[model samples]
Target: MAQVLGGITTSHIPAIGMAMDRHEEDTPYWKPFFDGYPPVRAWLEAQQPDIAVVFYNDHGLEFFLDKKPTFAIGTAPQYHNADEGWGIKPIPPVTGETELSWHLVNQLIDDEFDMTVCQELRVDHGLTVPLSLMWPGNRYQHIKVIPVCINCERHPMPSPKRCYKLGQSIGRGIRSFAGDQKVVVFGTGGLSHQLDGERAGFINKAFDQYCMDTLVGHPEELTRLTNDDLVEKAGAQGVELNMWLAMRGVLSEHVTELHRHYHIPVSNTAAGVLVLENED
Candidate 1:
């Protein structure tokens, strides 16, 4: 039987990745950022999960606004982390879990989740930053990735309720997959911060705490939150939280919080990391 080993939520701030690569973890700007990586890495190592079903939103880099799909899954055997006009990072591409990804894709489609399956796609900073931090080094070879791409940069995007439902569907779809494997659900994005207009540096400590609380104990409340509500509170760019809610939806209702770290000034964004325990 397939089971969720645990859940990880983190901000996909690209600068964090650069700092880690440069061994600047002790620097004032970067030291606080390491708060969650140790716990996350330990969590992954302990669970020894076979697959990582990553829930991350592309920054209009991989899937353009014109051809964006609300939810996309990578069914590829290998995924390259490409640099969109910017250059590629020093890190290498992430190899994918083909069989499990295919099973999830086929099962999700049958379950009526409209998902765009990609055979080959470049994972932008959104996916790579977290991957680099969580599983730095040749560790990627030991773990396989299944990406769940959400459209957060475009309008008429998936509503909060819709994303929650999609997560639920994905959870069921994976469980019913009939495969003998354990999987981990990683929800990557914002605690609370804004990056646009005059509100580019807004950080909502209250709202971020509330989000962490609801995601663990009362996910139903989170599911009811609208995209507009998040933008109003967390900032327009903060609506990327829809991706986090999707990952939370897959876990059990009573999730134990293992580690949490929140910090700001990483370029007008609040960066944080939270781990949810998966029992049974």
Candidate 2:
């Protein structure tokens, strides 16, 4: 069986990647921002796991509201980093671990988790931004990926409890996977920030800090809160926390915080990063 190497939690702010491309990791405006996670960069290199199961919401890039899927898994042989106005980064397509992906897809259905499987899909910043941060500079060269797209941008979204349960199903899926390899799971989203008409600049530092530490220590209570509570306190856009539950779900109550960071600026968003792996 494959052992899970660790988990990564981070925000998917599109601007972060843009900053990196401009070589502004040291610019006063962006230097300290990316530098906040020296430990994260080192941990990623050291672990060098074989596969990463990434959980991120699609920004209507691949799936639109017309046919949004609550949960979709990328089983494609290769996935392209799409160019949504900005030119595509042109990274080599990420090869899918089809063996394990198919295995888990069937099992997730058997377990009663509604999942949509796709053989070909283009992933936008929702998946790529966090990836560029976690595995910068050809990180994809070493690790293959399984993309888990959540429907956060759309209304009538999945419930917090359901997202938590989905994580449970994923943990069970990984445990039941009959393969001998190492893997890392990542849940990417926000701590607290909104992007609506007038509420765009909202930030909830208290809740952001609370959710950061609580994700590894007290996920049950974190999952209990509703979208309204997250919207009102965490800002409406911050409901992206639903994506984080996927990471929290698979983790045991005992896990160490390897690295974390939080910030808010552009488009009225709370940008953050949290990475955790099993202690064992």
Candidate 3:
């Protein structure tokens, strides 16, 4: 049976990707944030997961405001990346695990989760930035990707609990798969930040810290927060933490926190990266 090694959560701000494109990791403003990734890369090198199931929100790439599903899973043979006007150069295409994706799609629907299944997807920075961060220098090409997109940008979005449950179901599905592939999950986007209206450029470091520490073992505490509560505490776009919650949902109840990094004002967002290894 397949084994889930662990999950990783990280901020997917467009600026992070652009900084990498320009090779500016050492620059004063970006160094602190970029420095947090080397340990994660080293861990990945040692573990060498064969597949990455990315839990991220789509930022108008494949799904737009006009037609967005609360949950979507990609089963494409190869996923493409495009410059969504962020001026971030597109990375190399990501290979997909079609067999595993189809298996999970069946498992999710059977488990009562309505998922929009896609055989073609154009991934944006939300999915790619974390990949580039963890597997720099084209190393990501070695692993197949399965994108699990949550609707964090629209109203009627899945609540934190719902997303968490979704992750749990995915975890079960992965464990039941016949293949022996090793998997690592990714939850991308947000610690906290608001980019528009009266609350533009808003960030809550206190809330971000609380989430980082709490999610390690007390994810249920976070599930209690309603979407309204998330917006109030985490900011509008900050609700992207749903991806993080979903990532946590896939993890074991008691897991080791391998590494965590938090920085503020990364292009008006609270940037964070967490690596959690599933308990044996």
Task: Estimate candidate 3's alpha-carbon lDDT, on a 0 to 1 scale.
Answer: 0.91
The lDDT leader among the candidates is 3
Model 2 lDDT per residue over 224-255, tens place: 88877888888877878988888778766678
Scored by TM-score, the top model is 3
lDDT (10s digit) by residue, model 1, range 18-43: 67767888887777777657878987
TM-score of each: 0.95, 0.94, 0.98
lDDT of 3 at 232: 90
Better of 1 and 3 by TM-score: 3
Q: Clashing pairs in model 2?
A: 6-277, 7-276, 9-274, 25-31
Point out the worst 10-residue segment of candidate 3 by lDDT: 133-142
Report the error of model 2 at residue 37, Å.
Answer: 2.7
lDDT of each: 0.80, 0.78, 0.91
TM-score, predicted candidate 3 vs. hidden true structure: 0.98
Q: RMSD to the native, candidate 2? A: 1.7
